[model samples]
Target chain A: MILLAPWELLLLMFANFFSRATCMTVGPRSSMGFETCYCLSWRVAVEANNAQAWRTVPAQCVLYVENYMLGGQYNKDLDVVIEQISTYLNGIVAAGDGKDAWVLDIDDTCLSNLLYYQGKRFGGDPWDPSAFKSWAQRGLCPPIPAVLRLYSRLVQGGFKVFLLTGRDEEALGVSTAENLHAWGFVGYERLILRGPAYRGQSAVGFKSSMRKQLVEEGYRIRGNVGDQWSDLQGDFIGDRIFKIPNPMYFVP
Target chain B: MILLAPWELLLLMFANFFSRATCMTVGPRSSMGFETCYCLSWRVAVEANNAQAWRTVPAQCVLYVENYMLGGQYNKDLDVVIEQISTYLNGIVAAGDGKDAWVLDIDDTCLSNLLYYQGKRFGGDPWDPSAFKSWAQRGLCPPIPAVLRLYSRLVQGGFKVFLLTGRDEEALGVSTAENLHAWGFVGYERLILRGPAYRGQSAVGFKSSMRKQLVEEGYRIRGNVGDQWSDLQGDFIGDRIFKIPNPMYFVP
Candidate 1:
């Protein structure tokens, strides 16, 4: 049971409204505010440019990024969370089996383009999809500073690193890796991407399912770091969780 | 090309010796003085451990309690890595096209008892499997410190944490969860354990095959962390590799 920051709660509210209005479909758990809002925010967040602007945008239409977008800082709490993670990980390796490991997520947890949809005079309110695809192609957006350091250190420590993103399978190859490299992140032997829909429908359960599969293969996940509540729901082998503030936005 | 720390290099030397003498396995290329001492060290390290004089040894084993095992360390570098992950994940979610995910591992990476054998004075030179099993059942080990903090932070951040352990299927129930909880590690919705050996032979390509299965199941792993090199050799969807130190030792 984790508490959400005020801005995160507000963003969720906006996401709920936008989901209802846009008629977007997301994985199961459609029962209420979180799921729907989660979906809508992804669509909207990509169009935002900063946290403040995201706060200003309405839940309806979102503007498109006209050019390559990059750079922005998240809430200050981000540092505290990262520090806590570093400490936890150090303990695990020092005390537990000195194996290599760290669990990670791609969406809101790793990237920050969701702030792009904020306050821009868009086609409507909230955000739009067409504009975001173009922005992603540029791969210029900046990453969260604290988290970046964590990943880099893991690599430096000789621990095997893995990147588990829920992005489309199509985004594999140069697009995803290049984007990560551009942001000064490295050392991923594998870049797992989302596959096609399962059982004729999209579902958030996919992440969990995949996580289970990895366990069967013999990886001992030491730490799991992500932004969304769903990101932390799987069976990770770590002791604690590090959650940074995503007050400026939300995602499905 | 990760640079091994001085201690790590020394551990590799010992690992190479043990692996060659006991398993007759090919040593990792990265081990120092691979050609000359590879085979000799294997026999020597094992004999050294078995020698009566070396009853009390400090072995490189993972801190595995019941379920959760600690990863290791909180340093400045890991912070930057997670920050980059946050950036990519933010974009993926903003697109409303991706999902959230993290990859994990078991065995030395998660729950480990290898150190118990090395550190404790078991009789004889070469290690005995029975002694290792006895140590696991005893459950006297602690969790890795830094890894625990990472797990806590990730859980707090809202990501779905999945555990990927290589423990045989028989090691389930209270023992599993209890170990994790006791060590201060979190549990998962799904736990994947090793099925029976194939045709009485252990399977090849450890974690990679499982990661492939997860991809087929539609998971986009943004972070994949594990202690063994095999954990990072998979084809999953991890954008970064967060590795922790495992000088306590390695298994072939």
Candidate 2:
């Protein structure tokens, strides 16, 4: 290698530092010069249910996850899911017996808690139950527009829509229902929330038990939609299960 | 708008064309001035099992899929899954009765067909059964390195490893075994391929039936890993199910 002058060496060092800084800020690089976005991989794992029981977004990925949540990509992703749901809905022959039913998880599926999550580091911080409960009491969660459209279609098509959630019934039931109504989630047959019966139960256990109760009630559960795997898993998990994206937190 | 000279107008038009071209090549933008990578959304949807019965990668996403598969992210993603699996394995108290089993899917999980897929536009082309069969008959597929490592650990840790695949047994039994053996997967307890009894069955049906049979044989499936959701769905899905990424193709 040719030797560089002092000034030339200083300039080269500065250039290297600038490139390294850019990589750290924009995208991370592996030692082999391969750019690897671990945050994207983590988010994909979470979506696929491969990564289970995760409590928080990785610290390093907080900004990345925040951007992904607020970015146009999240809405576009929701649109794709909605398109698929609409296509599936089009092919259904509604029995018109008023027993044909659809199941939807409320939080992050019907009503988004993005406003509360915005202050929670987009799930980078540990879960705060009381803080979240207070936020729920305020009843400010917005409707995920695509899901609302799907809900309206389901309602008009004569399919019974059931909103199932893990929210505490005693504390936030009234506010939750009002928020859902304000956001146009009306016409749903039932809004089921976690009651004393489901206290200390896992999301999978509670939701699956509730779904079993629905099936026992003679409701033919046609489709299930949720942001968490727990909401879509276990016995009586309808004929078709649709998992929406939720990189923020895992229910179990 | 201000009036412009002919040369100035030409320069402005050129700039606009350049920016538009850059956007097209780098990312497709929505009309709302938001850059959206539909391809990334599609991949995420696929991983989440939200987009089901997909035949191939989206035409526009072929390059993106190719790069993701060949680039470092794929391996990084695998590492994340393996990390989770390893952690789960660490917590298990093996019975030491030789009935504790771990199941893994073959294609894309154990033996990768990446070399063959490289010629098929990385699954952008429609699947050709005869061509795929010829490639499998050749037995040149390589082991996914990370999975092989996991396999070795499982074997050494007293877990009976089972290799399950949808390949036809009559045509590919010997070659598939040899391929797996050559790839350092020699310690697997059994290599189960699709036989005549399972012909024309869906992946979910065949795999679940086989798993049920395994359970009947007094095997306790502690963990199951596969690149397809079909491998993880249905009855007897074991205590833990791990889904490895396979954006290149969907089995069902």
Candidate 3:
């Protein structure tokens, strides 16, 4: 009876159109498969934020801009996004065990490399090694919006927060911490950066090794969020690992 | 003729007694087992900045404290430690397959939380909700000694460095990054922290889940480092896990 209700039928029609509309929009810009993947991801991310259907699309779509396409143009509607991500994080934290819980990541995922991108003064191509090295040494980068809000909500909700990054270990003591304070981020219990590992592994290899170490230490990672696939690459089967958009670019 | 002559015997006896006397003084404290386990940790930590021995200790301790200790107190002795840990790390990075490596905890083991301690500013006990909240908000801390040097060495040496900590997700963006910068610590490829588990697991449980995540991603941790034993609780076997002193205090 409920399924046949006029209101229910109307709502179902709206959702179908909404999904199709999103697929149509993304399908042309990228490869067909990638487009399909993006559409599915967009839907998941949107639903992940808005508990309902696409009620929060406009809000979330702008967060991507706030993150990747910043400078000159700023969208005021982003407030909706900020609010939604915060709400999503709150739900995760609330879902946590009564004991401490947290999510972690580092690099462009949490600390924006906007400075790295912009520091080049928007010149010399996107991947400037020297500029990036200088940028990292300076330790100044804005917080990624969704990440900032998610972290804040988790902290505010009484869960412990951790920022695990791939920044060089020698530079972490100062650069990483100051960046966190400068950005007004709150509620992290510890900052885990790369240290030494067995000889010959790459940074990505080191990352997974570290995650495993955390398991040995006895802390559960409820929700893992990051821009790089490496950040989420772990055996943490039971937890929800949320990947935020890192459109500024990809890491190797 | 093969036996020692009278003069040679006398020389041997004199050398043995002299060695025994030296053993009575610094030898007991300098024994590999004791030094590695206890006494040398405290004494070496203090003298690390000035003593030549600082170079010989593992590099994990050096890079973890570069900004606060390596660059500050033992600035002059920094080079030796850098050289040593780099040599050690390079070997590991070169030799490691996906199956074996090490993970280091960033807080007291790699970086310093002295400010949190000396300021008497945790604001409240760890057990107190309000205090924990406040502490998470402040997010200002320094680096530990020896750690920075260790990190530098590991990075250069090719050891895969993964920083493991129990900090919550909320602090991922700002505090962690800033703190690392302040200390000038570097070379970590990943930072894993504690956060909420959707399946209702504790932070520790989530950490264990992460171990499988890391393995699937390709990389096995061969060793671990941290001030907290909890940082080393994951499932990878045969990896060495080293604990350093947390002079500021201990967590439950």
Candidate 4:
């Protein structure tokens, strides 16, 4: 049996509480004069989601995620994640000759906004941009341990590492750099964030162009890792794509 | 928040334990002479499993599902399910004349193997045929609460109900009948089971033939409910199909 800590168990129960509440609709329906407590279609979807081998959350459940990052389930899941990533990185290192690089996504992958998310109650309140920028300016966000370990090791071993995030550089240039430096993450070839001109662009399109430019500059991205599909959906997706888990809120 | 009884919480956890344990591989791999703790491919699959919106479980985790059927999750999910089933049944009753029937796949649909699965630990051991037969012979399987309620109401409202199971008639006929009667289920026109001659047939083939026979008898199947893909896959899938959650085992 997987040994979960006592608080971990509580955290799991806490995390699941959100998913269970996904289908709770108002009003009991009277079917042929029989009063029923739940909505049939939503209930079927809930059960189907549980029963299927795989499931995408209902479109509605994406915004209400309450405790995904706070729970240990997310981190424990990532432990298995980085182990596999380390294995793959080691393979690419062995197989390549030279000039190999890796692409990394910033938010929720390299740096976590655990505290900010806690304050936001995992997306219950509408997103406030000024508050987010103020939070970013604090540079208090921490490096995810597994990703930090992998990145530091990769850089020290002579691989060119690039930070490719969707955050706009005009908005977060110095703050983003300081945030990375504040958290023991340093020494990357380029910390590429979106330019002001690229505002309102699709993540897939922007990231793809950034990667294309990198490839044209003769750098081969051996691996790409991120939490969102948009981060990995574009064309120059590299030799391997390691997706970090982030079910709290969808970027797209 | 959804209210979960203590035993229900335990049961849900017990059910989930099966799916989680499935993907823990037997050995560590040598990636470029760096010994890894587990199969890197499998570990990658595990991470990928967590990353995707919906996912077919890694072959490893199907048996270790943690909280799928307990903690009020299952029953709460079913509320929506029966609502939909009732709607479809009501539609048939409104739209059609008489001779309408609903097809129900037995296990995990019309009748539940909740106790048997609980006792067996959701299929942990190598399946023992003799042990299973002995368990089935006891005929204590309870009806699934939501399905039983829908069925009884539909039957009382004048729609024919048919029980179509994959179990062999010679082996489970009396036991299945007795079990249904124990749950206050009676007066169905037929309880169809796979005959000895259909032993080598595929489920889709067997079920298809059964439905064909019923259709030839001038019966109009209004709806069908099941827990597996094969149960709803063939030609005579009827007017509507409702699937129940059963990730414990794939029947086909």
Candidate 5:
């Protein structure tokens, strides 16, 4: 071994730490720092719907969740899911009878609340209904580009797209529609918000009842897409359901 | 600035590179190399049940998948899921009724096929039924420790546990039961396997029919756990569904 200057020794130590932290290792655990490895597992658990009814993001994972939401991984994950949906759409031989329909969840599926979530520490803080309502009332949430593109494709493919959300219809009906329209979420057959009939129902119950009604109305739900598991579960869930990753929160 | 020795310059260069490669940044993309990020996104999509009917793991992601399956992250992820299940089980009032039942899937859920998968490139290669059957006939797959523990807790807590699998009864019945027994999987109410009437049925169909029969027979399915979504979907899926991580293969 050769002698090194003090600065050189510090640099060498830094390199070693970095290498140990970044490189993936084949063993009982990854070489990533414990925080990173644990947070990644937590996020995967959330996306897989194994960790249910989590009220808020773990405090330690706020930054991790923030980076993931704004980082390219979130967009890339969306791309993969959209690719599958596109492939499925291409394979469908649509019935000329006009009964083919598709369901899409509004928040975080068609429109992203990233701007609102940013202020809430990416869901590190408890949910504030009034705060979220004010944010939604502004009609400023941006369209999730990939989901917007898919919506366009579905409309063009002659599939009747229904925009469904758990937002109270009496309070948010106008603003939500305007926000959606501003983002070119055009041509959807219906925008079904939570009307008085679904006042006390859970998200799963509300969405399931809506889908059941759509089925009874003679529509064949070819596919359903949502950022929450509640949107894809329950009766009449359709032929194929695509789950978009949303670790920031769980609906039920 | 002070001039440095040649070795110091080399060390500084390495430190810079490592820092750039390892540090998590708040930006459009993570600082991780493109391969690692893309493979991670792919895995997430698969786990979220968005990437459907994938024939084999992406060739480039074979090593990534191997690391994830063998690495400590897999065990930690299992721990998170098991913790949730335990919390739920502890909260049950139990009604003191013997009808309280839990359903669990076998391959890759209760028993891990990692040994065979190691030789198969961690699902880099296409599935081979004959080869897998041969491996199963050996009755050598080890128990997933976390699941084995959960099974014991469920049994001791007065919940009837059902061991369900898509494995064929005629070919794998004896070996599978022996392997489970050899690994301390005792006191299960029944070991369900694919029999003659379910020969060509898909996993969702066969498992759904069985659960429906269980319901008709007055078994209250309190919880269902499986590595595959097919095991958790369809009619009569239990009150709670726990999806265990299995990135190695897709059943349907």
Candidate 6:
């Protein structure tokens, strides 16, 4: 690529900065695909140790995530993380106690609810509990390929994988389990759903607390892979915390 | 920070590229504390998701590793991976199967031997069999804190921690056992070092063969943690693999 002239580069930089500084697409086209500062300067930020540069994540990162998810970038990016995990697994010689746990989060982590998110246009709607519940009851969400492969390989490689999601246990338990099973997330140790008691709690607090319980119970969580940072947040998080991309919606 | 003009940004980029392109420090102090493209770009690379940018690793990354080893960065970096492991373990509800295994490598993985590496300035000297063998015989190599903690925790977590290294089992078996026990790596399942049969085999071939044997015997490799890539290499690897930094030497 030809180097940009000083003036031309400045113009491009200003345009990039302008777009991120505004919620320009928190409207009709938000989920259709939008660009962000991350998509602009990620290369420079990635190769440099400049912390300041990496902090350039777009304010409307969900838009970028939408595009990345629908575009080829998502698969390429996921492939890299998968390879890294495989490399990590290759070195592992499991404890074989059958207590080795690979904790997976449900939502965007295991099953990509792109359909819902796309329709919502990146949180364009609010508190439609009924509609969301109806979506879950469909029991038809597809499994994420990368996570599915990781889950299956890990089981063969010595881990007993489990799903620990924040879904309301009483309401979503049956469908969640059914959806997962039907979607090829066949054999897991358990599907731990949040109960009514967790109604108003924060994900971090809830997950951290629940994971603490797992530790106290004698389980050894070897790997926790999730899309949201919230999925990975909290106490007793596991041996490794791998955060998959999710700029769509902030749990907090 | 004020935004850089196009020219200024290009200048900085050029400088970084120049530093990495030359054998600038492949000299008297290459292993002392020289910087590499990694050190230069680690900050930005740390947080960004640009796989291509992050893939620009230095060819002589070992030199960069030397500084990181002596510097506080090594511990800090390792702490992250370790804490992640702890979190996983916390969520683990173990199977209590008598066959769970946590495979560990000797030499650089479990034992530090930093004194020699530092003296040699990160593989500065050529092969010194007598010196290395003598050092091993000293039975005084220190245990690495990060790995030591993982070992201890896995044991308490009901894992049958085992020593699987490239060291000669027949020659170093007694001393290896003695050294590990002496250094507080107590109560391992078994110390499987290379025997006469492994004399002419490569580390990858030998280790892979042994791990495969373990699998065929129905032993589950839950986790394998090591410093060298070779330690983590081969078939029948495990459930999860962790890599500790070691830029001093390349096993392959």
Best by lDDT: 5
| Whole-model lDDT per candidate | 0.47, 0.83, 0.48, 0.66, 0.86, 0.64
Off by over 4 Å in 3: A1-68, A71-99, A119-126, A198-200, B1-252
What is candidate 5's fraction of native contacts? Answer: 0.41
- Single out the weakest 10-residue window by summed lDDT for candidate 1 chain B: B65-74
What are the runs in model 1 whose C-alpha is more than 4 Å off? Answer: A1-73, A94-99, A119-124, A171-173, A197-203, B1-252
**RMSD (CA, angstroms), candidate 2:** 6.3
Query: Which lDDT tens digits does candidate 1 get at residues A1-252?
Result: 335556655554454443322222333333333332332233222221111223322333222111111111122234445655665556555323434566677655666664454433422344455666566656755676667888888777766566776666664445766788888777665667776653322223766666666666666666666664345544553444444444334444
lDDT order, best first, reads: 5, 2, 4, 6, 3, 1
Candidate 3, B152: how far from true, in Å? 53
Best by DockQ: 5
Across A4-34, the per-residue lDDT of candidate 5 in tens digits comes to 6677666566555543323234433323355
Which run of 10 residues does model 3 chain B get worst, by summed lDDT?
B46-55
Predicted complex 4: CAPRI docking category: incorrect
User: By lDDT, is 3 or 6 better?
Assistant: 6
TM-score-wise, the better of 5 and 6 is: 5
Q: Give candidate 2 misplaced runs (Cα > 4 Å).
A: A1-36, B1-36
Greater-DockQ candidate between 5 and 6? 5
lDDT of 6 by residue, A184-205 (tens): 8877777888988888898878
- Candidate 6 A-chain TM? 0.75
**Comparing 3 and 6 on TM-score, the stronger one:** 6
DockQ for the candidates, in order? 0.01, 0.31, 0.01, 0.07, 0.40, 0.03
**TM-score on alpha carbons, each prediction:** 0.35, 0.88, 0.35, 0.47, 0.90, 0.44
Task: Tell me the spans in candidate 5 whose CA falls farther than 4 Å from its real position.
Answer: A1-32, B1-32
